[model samples]
Target: MILGKCPYCDDGMIEVREKEVSGKKVKLYACSNAHWTTEDGEMFELRADASCDFRVWQNSLARYGKWLSYKDMKDLLNDESIEVELISKKFGKKTYYNKHISLNPEYGVSVIWD
Candidate 1:
């Protein structure tokens, strides 16, 4: 249960562990205080019920170039009526201006180019 500060509940620490999700083993972090758990290390929490065709989004981003912007995904997901929970007050500026947003390669959220 090694963890850093809880991304969801800043007051509590996080506990990193592996759990089966959607039939796959995912290493997710859970808040020590039971605030939240996520496969993305709590970078941002996309509600489990969020509905959006990830393939469509991935294709759309590919057309633009390499790397998908968080804002782009957030906007589309929001339009699709998917709720996104942000641990941080704002989507970090790192992805602004095609700066390449990071995604977990294991999750296959987007295609990777070698």
Candidate 2:
């Protein structure tokens, strides 16, 4: 199934490819745009099989525009097709956790919060 658009180029199409990693074959679907290829965006993986029930995973990852807490990072990552990085920030004598989420940089969708 067509999971997502390239998000970088209008003419680009997301495609699936099979590659061997750690001696095991895996299926990967990712955007075909050069920018996405360079930045590693919109990528999904599933084990090779005759059939893969990946729609659920894909659907869950496609939701957006909601306030989410730190506990929802995993779902947010999947939803935005981005990775989350934890950084430590010091305020006065205390340390707080900060989350940096990378979304469409060109569109100003990326966010950072504590």
Number of the top TM-score candidate: 2
Poorest stretch of ten by lDDT in candidate 1: 51-60
lDDT (Cα, 0-100) at 109 in candidate 1: 40
Q: Write the per-residue lDDT of candidate 1 for residues 1-114, one digit (tens) a residue.
A: 433443323365544445554465544444445433366542434455433212222332343333333444444323432222222224543232322332332343433332
lDDT of 2 by residue, 1-114 (tens): 344544445655445544444455544443444222212334533334312221121212222323333334334334764444333334634333445554443422345444
TM-score of each: 0.29, 0.31
Error of 2 at 108 (Å): 17
lDDT of 2: 0.38
Scored against the true structure, residue 69 in model 2 reaches a CA lDDT of 33
Q: Could you tell me the lDDT of residue 25 within candidate 1?
A: 53
Residue 53 lDDT in candidate 2: 22
Candidate 1 ranges with C-alpha deviation above 4 Å: 35-114
How many residue pairs clash (N, CA or C atoms closer than 3 angstroms) in each of the candidate models, in the order given? 0, 0
